[model samples]
Target: MNPGSEVVVTLRRATAPDARPAADVWLRSFAAALPTVVSPRSADEVRDYFRDVVVPLREIWVADAGDDGGGVVGLMVINGDELSQLYLEPDWRGRGLGDRFVELAKERSPVGLELWTFQVNKPAHRFYERHGFVAVEFTDGSGNEEREPDVRYVWEPKP
Candidate 1:
């Protein structure tokens, strides 16, 4: 891939077969983006969660780069009004994929959407804010599995 060229990525619904790759994306992104936060679940556990829970019970989407010989580059999970997860491979960041994921989430839940990101994830704060999500609440870390302070963001379409 050239330095200035944009890689084509297709966003589509994740199937049961995508569980492993999606989970891999989540793990890599989390490790790179949130180095200070420790995940409670192991890598295998996370893959299992994706296989048994996320794929079956949530609205999951994957950014497929297979057309360009790249595998899954990103993953997003939405449940009801909550944007539960959004992760992109470390090398795939800043290419507008995250923006696309948020747009799709809004389309899926047009009324409003809510999400939580660790307070330390300033880049995420900026990204979500850019997408119209406002930080509405801050927590002291007790409510999350990672035990890291987090901030809640909400997005509602204008009237």
Candidate 2:
């Protein structure tokens, strides 16, 4: 697809078969977005986590591009009021897919939502801020698996 062109995708609840491809999107997105942070788990471990835990238990959604034969281009996981995970294919960035994922997250949890992103990810900060989230907390890498300093953002529906 050409840059800045509108790409179509269907967002739907992930099925058992979507686990691996969703994990691949997550892996690729993570690598591209946070090249400096070291991940605690290996690629195989991430895939296993998606298959065994995320797909089975979480409110996970995948942006499927199968209509155009692009497979799964992005994935989002919402856990309660937390937008636990949101990742898109590197090539799919700037195409508004992330905005769509955040919109779905808000629709799923209209009361509010919270998420954490590493401090180094400026693009993520801007993205979430644009979607109405405010940075509410900052920590010095004490409480996360990656031990990377991070910021917490929260969004509550307008009164």
Candidate 3:
């Protein structure tokens, strides 16, 4: 394999050491993606939510850039059949990291996958759609903590 063409971004189960950085990724991407969507939680709260609730209950995966670059450029949170969260560093966008993460999610939940994103997050809509997810439902902000209008998307293996 050519050294220049080797893949830098790799995915693995997130460990305790990944908690802080993963939380940082989540917070940064969330804030950047949802500037117009009201969030009652601050950065600290977002971090704590990942460390306390998300990391404990879900399957957390991180995309590590290895020694040649800073580690953990992306993360995905999976809860059963749901792709609860997926985030990448601002610099990592458009670098195929999101598609790799979605492939990982598909590998984990081969039957189907589901996720919810704020209605204001247009980029997310585009990304998920590009990866074969379709909007299945929309809500008036009653089912989520942020109480923001949101949409649920689902993906299923092609028959």
Displacement of residue 79 (Cα, Å) in model 3 is 0.3
lDDT string, candidate 1, 1-159, tens digits: 667776779999999999999999999999999999999999999999999999888999999988563789999999999999999999999888999999999999999999999999999999999999999999999999999999999999999
Candidate 2 has its poorest 10 consecutive residues by lDDT at 1-10
Stretches off by above 4 angstroms in model 3 are 1-7
- Residue 60's C-alpha lDDT in candidate 1? 96
- For model 1 the local lDDT of residue 61 reads 97
lDDT of each: 0.95, 0.95, 0.88
lDDT of 2 by residue, 1-159 (tens): 667765568999999999999999999999999999999999999999999999999999999887454889999999999999999999989888898999999999999999999999999999999999999999998899999999999999999
The model with the greater TM-score, 1 or 3, is 1
**What TM-score would each prediction reach against the true structure?**
0.95, 0.95, 0.90
Instruction: Look at candidate 3 and give me any clashing residue pairs.
Output: none
For model 1, state the Cα shift of residue 72 in Å.
0.6
